[model samples]
Target: MRLITYRHDGRIGTGILQNDQVRPFVGEPAMTQVIEQGIGEVADQGIPLADIQLLAPLRPTSIRDFVAFEEHVEGVRRSIDGATGVPEAWYDAPAFYFTNPHAIYGPDDDVPFPAASVARDFELEVAAIAGPDRTIFGYTIFNDWSARDLQSREMTINLGPAKGKDFASSLGPWIVTADELSPYEKDGFLDLWCSASVNGTEVGRDLLSNMGWTFEAMLAHAARDSVVRPGDVLGSGTVGNGGCLAELWGRNGRQAPPPLTDGDVVTLTVEGIGSLTNRIISGPEHGPAVPARRRDPARARHERQH
Candidate 1:
């Protein structure tokens, strides 16, 4: 079952994606309710998916994405000051953050333009959506669009990714149930293939099996010293040797500049997942912008009212 939180009729609700429509889940304002009840239990509610507006499934109270891909990690390290080593803590610690949940968009949605962004790029990732009181329930494809130039400038402060990563992160049209992806549940190798095209030109391609840290490890690490509740999303970082410009350093690894410009259309496809297509707009009206705003207060009230 592909779970989704969508919007319609000026409201947000949880629903199951079947075919081209949504099947509304009953008596649950949030997906965490369904997850805690178990998918089977939620299914028993039997509300026709046709009814209800699908919001972002559930508004995550917090989100923490980690850099779990080994190839990307090593590649990034080596590219940074010729450093090839990752911190020992990095191996043991699952780094994460509170991403802007409201910033998420659906399939085929246009990624909003960011003012600080000059070289926009796409990151292919897999996100784990927590279920049942913070238990991880399912996985979905994620596209973390990046502004390479801004990210580089921000990193010099050694603060953290911050606005560098928060510009816009895209979620799915559907969330694949954990049961379906069970083969990848126990540290077993799961093939990951990521391909990106900009304005019909190929830019990046890579596999998931190449990740340095497995999903299980990432999950465990996220749970350490912190409780990951249901509806939380854990993102697998970009693929190794597969970044847009940060890793490429103005070259496509083929001796050509790889900078993204306005109007560039980026499409990222992850194996076993779906494709996320976004267009690079010019820039935001505001300069040195903050992260995109969350849901309108009025919208939140309306959801509860329904």
Candidate 2:
């Protein structure tokens, strides 16, 4: 079942998408609520998909983004280290970090390029919404928007991706339930292909099956010392080969492809999960400059920890 959360009748509504239309899941209230009830009984009335405005499937309860693709890691490392280098810890277990859930965007939303960035980029990823017993409730397209400059400069401090990534992350169009993907399943991997295009020009493509870590491993690791609750989300990180511009630039001898600019339309399509299309909107506004540094989000988080 393809589930959607959208605006209808002057208010937010939820429904199951079918045949280019939405069948409202009336008693469920929201996808998160319906998730709690279970995915077995999801049926409702109808509406044309073109009529309603959509939002992120649901504001996920919490989000954990895991780097699970070795090919992607090698691409990035080769760029930075001039040779491919996989971190030792990653070989032992899946690794991930928390991100701001508040910055999510729905399909068709216009993303204001985070002001502090010059090298604005996108990470192509797949995300799973949490369900009972650490299982996946469903999957959605995740565009992990990134500010390369800020991310690299901060990581040198040995801690942080704060301002670099916190600004915006997009997930949407709809969620494809796990059951719906069973036909495409193969030995714990989904036979799904993900590709991205910027302003109608194709930039990245990869198969979801190429991911090094499975959702089960990510969930198990995330829940090791804490609770993994309903409505939480976990990202598959970037897929193998070329999945982001940073990786692309890295692999291509640093000859940069055009970074996103105002009016650039970025569309990410996963053969089974559908697509999330967003436009980059430029604005004169910016957060405090990373160099100037008045307690930015990343720094603030660090200060509070001490």
Best by lDDT: 2
Error of 2 at 168 (Å): 0.4
Which stretch of 10 consecutive residues in model 2 shows the poorest summed lDDT? 286-295
| Candidate 1 segments whose C-alpha is farther than 4 A from its true place | 8-11, 40-58, 77-89, 184-187, 250-257, 287-306
- Clashes (backbone N, CA, C under 3 Å), per candidate, total 16, 0
Candidate 1 residue-wise lDDT, 68-152, digit = tens:
7666666555543356656676676656556676677666666775765666667777787877644568877777777666666
* RMSD, every candidate, angstroms: 10.5, 5.2
Whole-model lDDT, model 2: 0.83
Per-residue lDDT value at 171 in model 2: 92
lDDT of 2 by residue, 27-96 (tens): 6487777777765454555788888898899888788999999888878766644566687877898888
User: Which whole-number lDDT from 0 to 100 does residue 192 have in model 1?
Assistant: 57
